[model samples]
Target chain A: MKNEWPLWEVFIRGQHGLSHRHFGSLHAPDAEMAIKNARDVYTRRNEGVSIWVVEAVNVSASSPEDKGAFYEPSNSKVYRHPTFFDIPDEVGSM
Target chain B: MDKDLFQYLLRLGDNTLVLGHRVSEWCGHAPVLEEDIALANTALDLIGQTQLWLGLAAEVEGAGRDADKLAMLRDIWGFRNLLLVELPNGDFGRTLMRQFLFDAWQVINLGRLMKSSDPRVAEIAAKASKEAAYHVERSADTVVGLGDGTAESHARMQAALEYLWPYVGEMFVGDDVDAALVAAGVVPDPASLREEYDAFVGRIFATATLEMPESRFTHKGGKNGAFHTEHLGHMLCSMQWLQRAYPGASW
Candidate 1:
């Protein structure tokens, strides 16, 4: 049968205080079912306390063909690294 | 041994066991990948509950049987599941329709069972209730989505509801065994759950745009082991074949 259902990307919060991370994608009739399907597919083993599902179509991703233009320039900026900053011991653990 | 308690436990366990097996049949065949996984997860939860209920039943019986034995060794005449659970999954709509009907009642029943005088029953009910609550939410949503969605889906959902409604009455029907349990404070009377079940389903049906069947006629006898639909026997044939063919077989 043709899968007319829309594809959804699933994210899961593994525990309290954790951010939901991209886990996988699945087909569902709608967002409600997408979350339910996410639970069954990715969180069956108590892997998450929260879930978020968005339609795959809604997400805007950079094309792999533009990978050099999108990411290569960022590598050339060394000041972007926080490691270059010196911190006093009084600002402990920073 | 408390015979009444044993019977009551069987009633609880068999309902999950039978329905679990039925839902598991969708493992490879559900209409969509998401739904297939959802149905399998639901089946796993029911089977997990079955272990607890039937495990307690075996202990009460004191006849050396365990949960696996009780589940796999039982014949059609020995099962105590409501007939509603054993019906074939005619289609996705029919399957979820049956699930919503059963899950609605099961969640309410499990909620009340959480207060049972028997600590073990209460503990099991508490754990199973969590899963039942989720099951009901999903099933009810699906029912509404399909029942109100389109011409074909709406028609199918209505037909599924009508086909499954007659079998639902048996869940609330009780007899001497229930009386004994009630007297001991081990559980509530089955009939008492009807009002809440009606109100719950009524609201969902309204949203789903499906009319409730006017007929109140109920099919009975599955819980008491007095009678069962022919489907149960055929189901058990496949479900019990390995155990029956090789007694005491195990991994």
Candidate 2:
């Protein structure tokens, strides 16, 4: 019998239209079962309204050496920070 | 509170308590990590349901025996769970088979029990039915998946069904306690649930492509407190050791 099951990445949507945030990974035979395993492992506490499971192999990640090229360029763009915005008094709490 | 209600609560609570113990036994031994957590969660739900049933049972008994005492101190003859639960966890296949059988019965049982004439029992049943629904769904999925899976898995599942099928009769054989409760509208008649249970199990078996066992002989005795398989005594020995040894040492 084969001992190793395929690996999957779990994503959970906390609310409607919310981006599914990556929680962690687990091993399952297929995508449908990955969803079931994700339910058991990640959402036992009534945490998610929806779940998406993708094969870990199918995902592509940037290299650790490319971190500076990918993210550091955005670090100097301080205008992207919400702190730069001045809200009128009428925009209460925003 | 009548002795009949107390006895009925025992039958209900004992089933949860004993099977919770059996499921908990698989804490570290499940085939996969996901299943390990799933079984533990399932066991927790049963034990929680047991607390509700046993607490009510103690109040109805009114003899000062509380839930812990009833659960931890009882001898074999005092228990009223069905024989199906007490059977040892044979394999992954057998464990799921036992779970599917009981969860199927309980989903229907609790559905009816939630509307019990006795409000406390009804409240507990309402809460338990939600959890039992998940148990039945998860277990039934596993049963069908494995039964229709690889050749080895199919064979094992078929064997498990064969071994456990005979013990299911005791679950629905209403004794005097059940008769009184049914008459009081505190519960539905056990006979009423039989067809639904059969249909549910049959539908799953059909999907699994597994054949029903030929032996139609269904064993009975657990609900009456008159008979138990050897497994129950051994289970009680380890389960009761703490309370029996310390005699009420609490954390």
Candidate 3:
């Protein structure tokens, strides 16, 4: 049998209208099975009302090895910090 | 005789206890770790239900007996659980099939019992029904997954269905205790719920690309005081040994 099915990342919403939070991942034969496996794996305690499963191969992310270059520059951008502004007393009171 | 009520409660309690014990056997042996945890968690839930029901049974008996005494002291013949639960967990598929059938029945049965005239029974049933619902859903999902996933899984699931199908009849076989409860509105007729259970299971099987096994020989003995299966003895031995060895000992 072909073992080429992609890994899927599972995200679950705890209750209605909630955003799906990452739960875990599982290997599945297809998108449908991915969702079903997610339900079995993630929602056994009635912990979720909704689930979203995306193939892991389809997701792109910055490499951890590049975190220094990708994130350190942003950390030193002081103007981007909202705390740099002093609010007027009237605005603070409001 | 009120002993009848104790007997009735024992039947309910033993079914949960024995089945919980069987499911617990899969704690680390399940096909996957997630499923192992799920089955173990469900086993704990069933054991909790067993404790509550057995405690209530002790109260109703007025025998100065507690749940532990009743669970651990009784002989196998005194146990009144349906045979379905005592049947060994044959394989992963078989176990899932057994859980699927029992959980579905329990959800319906417990739902009706929540309206029971007895306040204690109703309260426990209400709480248990929620847990039972989750068990049913998870098992149903497994049945669907195995039935449709791979050719090997489909065959295993079908064989499991055949092995478990005979035992399903005993679940809705209303004994005198059940009849009285039904008459008193303490529980709905198990027979009435059978159709709904079948339809629900049928839908899942249909979607899973599996055929529901045709009802053939109905095995009827566990509730009527017959024990032909081998699993229950070991289960009872392990479950009852501690309490029996140290009678009246408690933390």
**Chain A (alone) TM-scores for all candidate structures:** 0.87, 0.77, 0.78
Give one digit per residue, the lDDT tens place, for model 2 in B138-214.
89989998999999999999999999999987777787778888989999999889889888899999999999775
The digit string of per-residue lDDT tens for model 3 on B1-251 reads: 35656777787798899899989989889876656777888898899999999999999998798888888888888888888898888989999999998888888888888898878889989988988987887788889978997899999998888888898888777777777777777767768888988898889989888888886568877876766466677778887888788877779
**Model 2 alpha-carbon drift over 4 Å, by segment:** A1-3, A14-19, A75-94
RMSD of each: 2.1, 2.3, 3.3
**C-alpha local distance difference test of each model:** 0.93, 0.91, 0.83
Q: Worst ten-residue run, lDDT, model 1 chain B? A: B30-39
Pick by DockQ: 1 or 3, better one = 1
Better of 1 and 2 by lDDT: 1
In candidate 2, residue B191 scores what lDDT? Answer: 82
Clashes of each: 0, 0, 0
Q: Is candidate 1 or candidate 2 better by DockQ?
A: 1
lDDT of 1 by residue, A1-94 (tens): 5648888999999999989899999988889888888988999888999999999999999899999999999998988888887899899995
Give the docking tier of candidate 1.
high
Q: Please list the residue runs of candidate 3 whose C-alpha ends up more than 4 Å from where it truly belongs after superposition.
A: A1-53, A89-94, B246-251
